[model samples]
Target: MEEKCTTLGKLELEAQNWFVKVIVAEKTPIRFLRWRRQQRLVFVDKENERMQSIIYEQDVDQLDKLLELYKTYHVGNAKIREITGNTPILGTSKHQMILSRSTYIKRTEEHERIPIDHIYQFTPFSELPEIADVPTKQINLLFSVIHVFPPRFVERTKRNLQDFVIINEERRALILTLWEEFLQSEAPYLTKNVHTMPILISFALKF
Candidate 1:
């Protein structure tokens, strides 16, 4: 019998096995925690619904090798659970997927069903004042880079921090901060073209 594919929005905690054919929308670098290494991948279903998934220390390497940005995959045998506590949940779905060594993940050919681009619901700069008052919610912003400051190494936190001045179509400006890994990977490019006014779309930004 063939496995039936399910959309991210249809996933429920009660289901032990989930079969999803989705595009790998976003992938993060492995984060080193005190006890374990972890990585996150955001998958987008045919409906354009996204869900965040975690690969713990054990499965990080294996899955990282298999998953790539904007690629389509058939996923199954992954555990689904409700997100709890302070962790900022991504997408419309409240539940998250957990992948392990036993999880079935196979990269498949790209199809028109799933979107290759990352999904973001951008909030206007004029509305930021109200949204800033609500700290619990994460929002997306679209802006142009007006300035990029030199990266600073913080001895106390052992992290690199960089700042960028951005503005929206209304010319309203705001300061954006980039921390740690983003400095090494994203800062240089933004800094190089800061004067050219590059358009930037930031996802999941919180006050």
Candidate 2:
């Protein structure tokens, strides 16, 4: 038999308003919109790849807690557990907060807690795995700098793919291809001077 759970007490809400409050794991996209009926469904923007989220008639008190945490904390070193209605509430270990993968999607705004260094190995294991025997390969990285010919009046058929900053740290720079709709001005803006940069630099396809 399904247990009959007690419904929460009367919440002060305007008519035609369905209030829901959820703790967001990642920052929502800048361009986000949701109609009243569509709000019943989780995925708003399929291109963003943020289709997973828990959607239900949530308590307003829980929403208040979420707003408080969002405003109080900065990007790094923010505490979310103290909030009353935080889903997947407890941390697995003392150092890690285990918010489920689905909660991470369905972001409605741009607000996320970034790590200090913002640099971490993308591999699955923190330490070396004991299972598979991996073959070794001596990859020779070729380094060269192709200068920008005629900086002004630049008619780039491709995007950042046309530009190259070849360096020899025995590392190969990722070759990115740009789309026709993309402009050259936007190219410089896409790639930033980051202290911790990703090796696999490539064109971001919205679709």
Candidate 3:
């Protein structure tokens, strides 16, 4: 008998004992919230549907290290949840998956049908002001790195953050801030080659 698999579109808050084969698309740095560490991730199914998953502090150490960007895995025994309180500032789906200790994720061969390319709606810098009034300030931006500053440590938030000077084709300039993992992973090379003006795309940004 063939194993059963669920797609992101078919997941519901009441469902249980579901399995999904997906590719890790985007992963956010571990952030400190209320003194606990938590991380957010976006996964893509074979149908190109995107859903966000959150790992709480307790599960972060175990699951966060196991998952890698663009890697495919078979996930099961996870919790499906309804998004509430405020509009999602990062993910595309109305529902989210919560990973716990009981959740099982097995490394799997990359599904050929699952796209590896990032799906983004790059919002222009010129349009940022127009959407500022919207309840959800989430937007995506693509820009060229003109300058990168040294990383900083905040005593208040107990976090690391870095700022990058970016510009668009229209020559509109803005400061892009990156936190946590981005500083350690991406900022080093970008800082060294700021003069070369490397292009970068950032998603789910606040205006």
The prediction achieving the highest TM-score against the true structure is 1
What lDDT does each candidate get?
A: 0.81, 0.25, 0.80
lDDT (0-100) at residue 64 of candidate 3?
Answer: 85
Writing each residue's lDDT as its tens digit, candidate 1 over 78-144 gives: 8888999877787678888898989888877544345655455678888888888786566788899
Off by over 4 Å in 3: 1-3, 87-89, 111-113, 149-162, 169-172, 178-189
Candidate 1 accuracy as TM-score: 0.82
The lDDT, on a scale of 0 to 1, for candidate 3 is: 0.80
Name the runs in model 1 displaced over 4 angstroms: 1-3, 116-118, 153-160
Steric clashes per prediction: 0, 1, 0
Candidate 2: tens digits of C-alpha lDDT, residues 1-207: 012111111112221222222222222221212431111111111112111222223322232234322221211111122223322211111122112222322223444332212211122121113312322211223233332222223356433234434333444443333333333443454444322342322211111
RMSD of 2: 15.5
> What does candidate 2 score on TM?
0.23
Q: Per-residue lDDT for 1-207 in model 3, tens only?
A: 016887888888878878888888788778787698988898887777778999997899888889888788888878888888763735557889888778888878544335666555678789989997786666777789998788899999999999989999889999888888677777888898899998876767776
